[model samples]
Target: MLKYYNELLYFAQKLVGDKEKAKDIIQETYSKVLETQNKREIKNQRAYLYKVAKNVAVDEAIQNQKLQTAVYEESEHLTQKHEQPEEIAIKQNQEELFMQIVNKLPKRAREAFILYTIDEYSRKEIGKIMDITSNAVEKLIKRATLKIEEELAKKGF
Candidate 1:
């Protein structure tokens, strides 16, 4: 189990894209595996550990998505008294345009850009999460930025 710790952590990180969350998932996986082991005889511990980690990560992702949706819906009902209607509409339009531009990016480039800009992850951290070199992460981010800039320029903003 100790020998597989590093391997499982890397696997979980790739699945979830967050180091601390991956560690928590791995811990939960070990706990669940141990509880199951006590109940029955197990032949393949390594495979079992990976399967458990995958399942836990998937479950967490689903839960997070649901929570985010609920929060977004709730926030929609809470109006900001300070912002005028024009200001609110402009902000929403800007956000929508930015999202449209980001969606046009290639998958890897978009992920790198979002991790760096939106999620506030450093290039080194993004590289580790994406399993790429820091240089590769930089290139991806640059490509994404260039595409976004071009799109925004065309829109006269």
Candidate 2:
């Protein structure tokens, strides 16, 4: 159980994408799993623990999202240092172009792709993090992959 804690922490971090939030979520998950185990008819302990942890993670994410405020103040401050609106406009244009390309990807495929390609995660590692099979990760990456020729053709990556 203690050994699995490290893996659990890893999954929570990847799922939450924030170290501090992941720590809180994992701690809550451990407490809940222990308390539930003590009071319940023990069935599949491992699955039960995973299910409990997953639920806690989901709840935490939803709760955090509801309170989130998307702010561009920091970006605006940086733009002041850029000395010109052209620089700011260029930055905005680049961001828009990148997102346009990303939006073309399938949902799970894009998630797996960004995690694996952009973040340099392994298929096995991403599988555990995304709660999917390794083969599924591979397929998602393959499906989302753009050939160099195709990217060049569309002027997108």
TM-score winner among the candidates?
1
Candidate number achieving the greatest lDDT relative to the actual structure:
1
Model 1 agreement with the true structure over 54-93: per-residue lDDT tens digits = 7898789777875565456647765564353324445666
Which residue runs of candidate 1 sit more than 4 Å off their true CA positions?
Answer: 1-82
**Residue 133 C-alpha lDDT in model 2:** 99
Residue-level lDDT tens digits of model 2 in 1-157: 4655766677677656788887888789878888877897644444454556667876875676742331333243343535433344445555666666667777788899889978999999999999999999998888777632355356542
List the global CA lDDT of all models: 0.83, 0.68
Pairs that collide, model 1: none
Among all windows of ten consecutive residues in candidate 2, which has the lowest summed lDDT?
67-76
Q: Model 2 segments beyond 4 Å from truth?
A: 66-157
* Model 1 weakest 10-residue run by lDDT: 81-90
